[model samples]
Structures are given as structure tokens and as C-alpha cells.
Target: METVSLTINGKKIVTEKGKRVLWAALENGIFIPHLCAIEENPLPFGSCRLCFVEIEGKKEPVASCTEEVTDGMIVDTRTESVLRLVRMAFKLIMSRHPIICRECPANKKCALQDISREMGFKLKPKRLPQILPDLPVDDSHSLFTYNPNLCVLCGLCVYICNEIVKEAILDFNFRGFITKVGTFKNRPLAESKCNSCLKCVEACPVGALSRK
Candidate 1:
């Protein structure tokens, strides 16, 4: 792999030529808030919109996951514009995810909790009303539980299930505010052809999918 050098947050770092800014910064010990970023997936959709970064000469911040690094590139991960976008993205994601962590399986082990602690953001955004899907918990799998109400719709579970695990059992169902990860025809996991690989549960950042 061809290597290139770039500057991120005043620190010069060298990385592979085609690496995305997100991976480059992360590998070099720079933390830019992100979700819905899977290194294996080449075509990132930037859905979470939390990895925004200010690049030199760019009019607006760009999602680092979808932006490839270039030699001698200058990147600022915490500019005013970057923070505005990241804070809003975090707020929007948290608006949909329930903040009741005490009873959740992930609890201290959740990614949202980590992001909250790292970014100094609240788990529940004030003024932004929570719009939970209020879907029923699917405990029929016998190995894990699926709680749609707590899902942040980061698409990690769906991508892992369909792309990595090749289970093809989970995807975004419905659209817009009502969207959620579900089986085809909205059937329960018990009726679907799930192999119980549990990759989806492991990929879940929040507690939407958790082991029993």
C-alpha cells in the first residue's frame, strides 16, 4: 500500500494513500466523533453525520468516513464548524435512542456512553424530544434480544448481518421517523432464517441488540 503523510489536529501522521480521514485519524490516536463507520465497508453512506471535520480550504465540514486522505492534507477535527455539526449529529442520534441506561444490557459497555463521556455531551438532548419507535422487544431468538425502541439507526447491526455475516436477516425497514432494523416482511427473528451467529448483536453500538 502506498503511504502518504498528512496533518491532523497539528500532529503530522503517515497513512496509506487511500485511507479515509476517519481511519487515518483514528489509527494515529486522534478521536473524531463517529458512528456508522465500518472499515470493511468501502462505500460509506455517512448516515450518522458525526464524523465531520474541517479540512483546509473547504467551505464546509465533511464527514471524515467518506473523505479520503491526501498527502500534505491539513485536517482540523475540532473547529467551530466541526463542533457545531458533531454536536447536532450527536443530539439527533441521541434524540431517537432512549437514555435509560441502568436497565439496558449494554450499560457501562455501550458506545453511546463512551461517546458521551469523550465528547462531553448529554445522553439525552434537552429540548429535542425523544421519538422512540416504541416497538416491542423481540426475545424469541433465545440468545439475544432486539429492542427497536433503543436503536439509534446507526446501521452497524444491519451491515454486519448482511455484509459480513451474510445472514441477510436484518435491514432498515419502513422509512423516515418510523425506520428500524427488522427482518423481511417485518417478521420476528424466530420466523426468519437467523443462524444465531450473534454478529449483529456484537456490532450494535447501543443496546438495541444485546445478548441475553
Candidate 2:
């Protein structure tokens, strides 16, 4: 494993070459607001662009989840532009997520909630448009519930089930804004090959997937 040196927030740090900027900052106790970035998942989801970082010589803030560390890199994780991008991303995520945090089961443990507080942003919609049409809660499984309304479409479950678990039961159902996770033919998860392993439930960052 090759090593590279980079500067994050004016602190010089050395990391393995090809390490994702988000994980590198996190391992060193430097917080970079992010969601949909599971260390176990290899591919970058990039659905939530909250991990944007301003790198020297680069005109725009790059998605830290997809950017690899390089030698002599000057990375600014809290630049004005980077903060603006991250704040907007959190706002967009909250617009679709229900604002009634007090009643939510994952309120205290929610990554979205923690990151919003850290970034000094409110979870209120703030005029950002809502996403996905109304979706019914799939309570077919006795142990778990699936609510598409709270889903951020991070695809962590899809990746885990399809790639990691090799279950091939769960996947995105539609294209673009209409996309939603489901079993083939929209069948109930209990009726599908879910096996009730709860891997998908664990991968979900929001209360979209939860144990009943």
C-alpha cells in the first residue's frame, strides 16, 4: 500500500494512496459531513454530495467520497464554497425527509440529524422541493418496515443485498425521481427472498428501513 501526504484544514496528514477523502478525514477525527458512505461498501454512492471538499488547483469542490488522496494535495474541507455546498445538500436531504423529528424512532441516532447540527443547518424544508410521490409503508414483514417516503435513495441496501449478500431480491424500481426500492413485481418483502437477515435495514441511514 503506497502512502501520500495531504493537508486537510491546514493540518498535514499522510494517508494511503487511493483512500477516499471522507474516510481519511473521519479516521483522523476530522468531521466531514456525509451520508450514504458506508465503509463496508466499496463503490461510492455519491447520492448525498455533502462530503464536498475544495482541493487546491481545482475550480470546484469535489465529492470527497469519490476523491482519492494524493501526494502534496491541499484540501480544504471547510471552505466557504464547500460549506455552502454541504449545507445545501443537507437542506435538500431534509426537504424529502419528514421534519417531525421528535416522533421519529431514529431521532437521536440519525446521521442526518447529527450532521445537520454539526453543520449549523435546520432540518426544516427551507423551500426545497419534496421528492418522490407518496409511497405506502410496506409492513408485510413482521420484523421490519419499509417506508419509501423517508428514503434518501442512497442505495446502500441495494448494494448490500445485490452485491454483498448476493440475494438479488432488492433493487431500485424506477428511473430518476420516480425511483424507489422494492422487490420484483412490487411484491411484499415477506413474500420475496428477503430471508429477514436485516442487512438492508442496517444499511439504511434513515428511518426509511427500521425494525418494527
Top-TM-score candidate index: 1
| Candidate 1 off by > 4 Å | none
**What's the residue-level lDDT of 77 in candidate 1?**
95
Taken over the whole model, the C-alpha lDDT of each candidate is: 0.88, 0.84
Model 1 per-residue lDDT tens digits across residues 66-145 = 99999999999989888888888889888877788999988998888988888888988988998766778888888988
Residue 60 lDDT in candidate 2: 91
Highest lDDT scorer:
1
Clashing pairs in 2: none
Put down candidate 2 lDDT per residue, 25-132, tens digits, no spaces: 998888898777777766878888889999999999999898888899988888899988888888777776766578776778888888877877887757787553
Q: What's the CA error at residue 45 for candidate 1, in Å?
A: 2.2
Clashes of each: 0, 0
Model 2 accuracy (lDDT, Cα): 0.84
TM-score of each: 0.96, 0.92
User: Candidate 2 clash total?
Assistant: 0
